[model samples]
Target: MLVEVKNLSYVYSEKTPFEKQALKDVSFVVDEGQSVGIVGATGSGKSTLVQHLNGLIRLKNGKITVLDIDLSAKKPDLKALRKGIGMLFQYPEYQLFADTVASDVMFGPLNFGFSKTEAEEAARRAVNMVGMDYDSVKDRSPLELSGGQKRRIAIAGVLAYRPKILILDEPTAGLDPAGKREMLSLIASLKGEEISTVITVSHNMDEIAEFSQRVLVMNNGKLLYDTTPSELFYRLDVEALGLSLPHTVRIVRLLKEKNIILPEVLTEKDLVAALLAYAGGRNA
Candidate 1:
């Protein structure tokens, strides 16, 4: 296993009256370079799980390993571990404080011990990876850019670190349609890299269905189901757990009722063609 978790559990304020259990013996493993999507309600331990991944929260119990190191043990080198896993939280743009976009994007690399020139080069490379123009946006103040531009700069900061694994929680939480599109496009492009694994928590069922190789769904601090997005969305158990099927999934299922043989994938364009095939085949 590239990343392993064996019976992990965490409690907030243990031995105190405000104590709350965040994760209860949760266990799973992610292979290298996999696209995993995590879905959960507001307080269903999603945030806690990702936080623990990058050592933001010290693991209090059970075995957690990433990149061949045990996180449960007393860690003497947290920074080195963090450099292997990049995490970007929801609404990350609100944290940008640098005078220029280049400065903000290079912050992580500089902190990782890269020299000024190396950091700037990494920042420019990452900016291009996120589909942003380094020349046009580098000198501009992060605050002066559009919302989409700010979001890109924030994501580029994490990318500049060149982490082997990427984890994002609710990455598209606050954005207009175009901004959301840009962010999602950048996210989708991360797949198929030889050296990195991408994981994200997304509420847009359509997005998950389209790009994710596997999905881990949670509700009420407990893991409910983990499966392929197409399989999970079509199951009655998912709908019973207060999750709705994506619009395209619902329409595709309706077409199946009329004897349509749709593609196995769950995507809007695929479903549209499947429905058209079913309707047209009916006349023959």
Candidate 2:
């Protein structure tokens, strides 16, 4: 297992008037080369949980061992831990502050002790990985790029360090339809090369259903479900847990209600193909 959490729990502002329990005895494991999706309504402790993987949120009342760093330690090797994990939060473009795209992308590797030359090389590779030409964007000020471009550059910054595990929070938020597809494709492409593992948190059920092999559903700061997307979306009453089915799944269910049964599908393309096959079979 690449990560292990046992009996994890956290209370925000302990003993204070505003104290609230954010996580309640949650536990899960993530292995290498797996794509995991985390889904939940707002304030569901989804963000709080993944933060512990990289030491962004302190481990106050839980046991978490990530990449063998032992996050439960009073003072864990955070610096070492970070080098193996890359995290991109919601609206990551807001985090960009360097004078140039090159500088921004190189920041992580440099901060992690890579020499200037090595950092630039990593930056160039990362920029290319995100489908941007390094020579074209390297000299431009990151603050001046378009929103979609800026988001890609921000992702490049995280990829520059070549983390073993990549964590994304609402990566498609604020993106146009085309930009969303591009972003998702870029993440999918990095599965086994630049990143060994992926953990994505999103409210978009369609994206989660299509992209994730495994799914983790959070409800009111608790691990409500740990299962595969096929099982969660197809076999479970997701809405009862305050979640919606993927649009494709919803369409299929609606057709079934109309006496047009089709195989349970999770993508738009598959849904269309299933409908066509059904129509052809009926005509025959």
Candidate 3:
């Protein structure tokens, strides 16, 4: 396993009246080179859980082993562990403050002790990988770019360090259709190219269904289901947890109710193909 969590639990404001249980015995394992999606409604602890994976949140209880290092250990080398786990929070672009785009992208590698020349080279590669022209944008201010451009540049910053695992929180939020598609495509390309494991938390079921090999559903800070995307969508109570089925899955179900039987579909491309095949069979 590339990551392991056993009986994990966390609390916010532990000693205050505002104290609340944010996570309850959440446990899951992620294999190397696997893509996993996490889905849940608001306040389901999805954010808190991923924070712990990279040592951003301290472990109050339970064991978390990330890249073979025990996160629960006292005085664990958090900096070292974090270097291997690239976490991009919601609106990560808002965190950008460098004078130049290249500087922002180079920040991670430079902080990790890469020489100036090597870091600049890494920055250029990462910027290009995110679909930006390094030569054109390297000197520009990250804050001056469009929303989608800033988001991609922020991702490039994380990529420059070359982490083994990449975790994204609501990566496609607040983007137009085209921007969302491009961003998701960039994220999907990370596996096998730069990162070994990809974990993303999103409310978009369609994106999750299309991207992830495995899916995890969370409800009220509890892990409700962990299975393949197909299996997870098949559960009767999925919507009761405040999540909707992927559009393709719901459409297929509706067709089946009308006796237009078809194999399960998760993506728009799959749905179109299935419908075309069904139509052809009827004409035959």
Regions of model 2 farther than 4 Å from truth: none
What are the models' TM-scores? 0.93, 0.98, 0.98
lDDT of 3 by residue, 1-284 (tens): 89999999999999999999999999999999899999899999999999999998899999999988999889888888988999999999899999999889999999999999999999999999999999999999998999999999999999999899999999999987888988988987877787878999999999988999998888888898898889988655778889999999999889989988898878889999999999999999
Residue 265 in candidate 1, Cα distance off native in Å? 4.0
lDDT of 1: 0.82
Q: On residues 1-284, what C-alpha lDDT tens digit does candidate 1 reach at each position?
A: 66787888888889999988888888889998789998876677888988888888888888888887788777636787788888888888999999999999999999999999999999999998888889888999999988888888898999998988888877877789999888887887776652368888877777888778899887766666778887798764666666667788877677679776566658877877776776688777
lDDT of each: 0.82, 0.92, 0.91
Give candidate 3's whole-model lDDT. Answer: 0.91
RMSD of each: 1.9, 1.0, 1.0
For candidate 1, which ten residues in a row score worst on lDDT?
Answer: 187-196
Judge candidate 2 at residue 112 and give its lDDT.
Answer: 98
Question: How many times do residue backbones clash in model 2?
Answer: 0
Q: At residue 85, what lDDT does model 3 achieve?
A: 90
lDDT of 1 at 272: 72
Clashing pairs in 3: none
